[model samples]
Target: MNGANLTLEVLKRYGVDTVFGYPGGAIMPLYDALYDSEVKHYLCRHEQGAAFSALGYAKASGKVGVCFATSGPGVTNLITGLADATADSVPVVAITGQVASPLMGTDAFQEIDVVGLSLAVTKHSFQVTEIEELESTLHKAFEIATSGRPGAVIVDIPKDLQLAEASSKPVLVETQELPVAQTDSIEKANQLLRHASKPVLYVGGGVSLGNAVEELRFFVQSTGLPSVSTLKGLGALDPQDHGYLGMIGMHGTKASNLAVQECDLLIAVGARFDDRVTGKLDEFAPRAKVIHFDVDPAEVSKLRPADVTVLGDFKKSLPKLTTEVDFSVWRKKCIELSEETGFKYLANANNPTGNIDPTSMLNELSQLMEQTSVITTDVGQHQMWVAQHMKFAEPRNLLTSGALGTMGFGLPAAIGAQMSRPDDCVIAVSGDGSFMMNVQELGTIKRFNLPVKILLIDNTKLGMVRQWQRLFFDKRFSETDLSDNPDFLQLAQAFDIQAETISQPGEVTGALQRMVKSENAYLLHVRINEDQNVWPLVPPNTANQAMLEG
Candidate 1:
């Protein structure tokens, strides 16, 4: 068998049912092999789109996503997605076609050192020079990508290698088992949980990636502790759960931030103490004794030193750490804080003509969508609004570019997610500025007939940046104006996709219902006031408790 056929066989063995990519010169042989394979291939409009789509698939399905691209520009286009996956700890396998091995340093057509460029961004990378090493190399890549501390892995295969015949049949490689937590460490963590009066469970993306949501819910419910999550950890527990206090960080809810500030013991589960979540390291959870649990040992004390570090698989650690705790007083205080500082949106009844309030609209949309619906968003005020208003019932239901904060992530991500879970209702909630970043994916949607409802919030400016300038820069808006935006409804119509424009408050609910019920791809362009901002923001260098609200 040839290397290309062997590669496909290996992917199939690893249970990769779907892949996203754009075909090009050096990768033709692989595409040929893909044509006859049972695996589904989604041809994205661009290489970047292909990479992000793969990322979205990995994020939504807890499975290692795969993407293919040719040499040079194809590989270069994948850099952002690779970096994004690395930062967010999303497991992805990127396969890039290289110039023939004989090219050496001759600078052949489409030649580039993908391994060198990707080294900084990927968990591991391979330059497959020998056809004999192809199967093992791919197996290693998958193992490394999905194993402890999940991240992106790259395999750059030369064009000649793809065409080279293999001498023997490929064999499946066994994956390494994740390390278990030390019994003493688990005991230490339990001791802290047993003694604390004010304790907060801070969960992050790791819980979802580790497939430990059920365990996490059990632990939270068993302890009766208040919980808060990072942006990527939104759906680890149901938003309506009494223990959940919404997201924790810069745009975290007041209840979450205050709880973090006042907690006597902070139990960090699968969540790294990133700068965004900890505004000022010296002041963040100042009085709390930390108990950190993670699969990666390095992150245990990388930032905030842990009083007790349980390094192992969350699936094992979470259940063992579960203990009965009486925190009635702490829970009541948290409830009071939530009631005092909880989000309060302006009523739709008071909306003036022509200007719609985004908060009210998001609240309404959240109610209309199914509990199991998947919502993907680009980075902006709309993203924050969705995080605040939407109620997620399970992990991966709310997918966004958390660590990287990539602006163009929503549309392509939604495309990938819809393809992964064909029966689920997928919605792409994007700001006008974010939507335009990779708006060309509308073509991909139309081409594939993907029923992704695009809910575009057009505020006529870079809302997040403008809000920052207004608050911190003496109201100097600078070049943030985007008032001359194109008509998004017409843009969608140009792709032969149905679209509607809504500017008034009364038009929101009906338009949303229509868009959700539409059988075809649809875009509902919502126009709103440019001045609307995401509140409960923690200013740079300030403590999370020092939040500024509208």
Candidate 2:
């Protein structure tokens, strides 16, 4: 086999059945090789969308996703998606074409240093120069991407390398170990728990990586601990569980933030204390004894120092910790907090302020879709609203660019989700600003005839930024307005997709129901008033009681 064919063969052995990418000069030889291969490749409108689609596939399917791009702009466009994957620890393999090794630093046509640029964002990266190293390099990339807290791995293959022949045999790759958290420190954490009056469990993306949703549930159930989750940790606990506190941090619920503030022992599980989660680090959980547990040692004490730190995978540690800890007293405390807080959403709450209420729409959506429909969201007010309102009973039900918070993420992600689970219903909730960023992916969805439903919340402005401006910058608005959206109904129709426009509270349920039940891909343009904002927002560094009520 030629070098390009060999690379394709390696991918086939790895069980990579699908790929997303765009063809260009340096990557053309691989594309030609792909033609003779069995793998299915979807030609995305932009390289960025391709990367994000790969991410969506990985996040939803719980497997490594593959995407390829040409050199220069194509390679550069994938950086944001790579950064997002790394931050969330999603297993994604990104392959980009580069100029031949002979032109390494000469600024050859379409040449760019993708390895250097992607190094920090990726768990590991490589520039494969030798044909003999191709098989080994590809093997290691998958291993690194899937082992440990799974993260993105970038492999840059030069144009010349793709056409070269090598006599080297394929090499087998082995993972040395799954990243393990130290168990020696569990005793110290237990000591703190024993003495604590009020303790809280803060879960994050690591819990998802551990695939310990049931383990977390078992531990929480056994102890009855009130829990708060980072955005990435949503669905780690059953949203319907009474003991599960709502999400914590910037967009966190009122009761959850206040619970964190009042706790005597803060048990942070599989979570990094991000600045967004702990604004004004010195003042965060100041009086509590924090026990940090995570897969990555670097995450421990990186932001807030942990009184007790356990470095290991949550899956291994959680089951062991559950066996050793006694939570009868903890369960009683959690029950009291859950009852006192009554964090359940009240749909009829007074909203006399006249802003377009996104929560209302979210509640409507929740009512309309089944618990089985997998939902994806773009990062914005709508995303937070959905997180707060939608009830996720299953693992990996709600997919988003939580860690990276990428704006143009939903449509492509929806495409990937639909492709990954063709039998299941998939929905992408997007705001006008976010939808426009990658609305072109609508073509991809329509072309594939995937039954992915897109609910476009057309608020005519950047709602999240508008809210921030309202609170922080005296409502100056600035460049938050978005006035140039294509007539979405016509655009969808142009692509032969079923489309509808919905306005008013009375129409929301019927419109969503029709869209969700459609056999073909559909677009629902929800014309919400432009001035809406997400509510129950915990102002930066303020007490949770000071939450903004929409």
lDDT of each: 0.89, 0.82
| Shift of residue 32 alpha carbon in model 1, Å | 1.8
Worst 10-residue lDDT window for candidate 1 reads 345-354
Model 2: worst 10 consecutive residues (lDDT sum): 347-356
Query: lDDT of model 1 at residue 178?
Result: 84
Task: Please give each candidate's TM-score.
Answer: 0.97, 0.94
> On residues 308-416, what C-alpha lDDT tens digit does candidate 2 reach at each position?
9877766777766643455557556655665775445434234454333567767767777787788999989899988887777765778888877899999998887
Q: Judged by lDDT against the true structure, how good is candidate 1? A: 0.89
- Highest-TM-score candidate: 1
Stretches > 4 Å off in candidate 2: 167-170, 322-357, 543-545
State residue 97's C-alpha deviation in candidate 2, in Å: 1.4
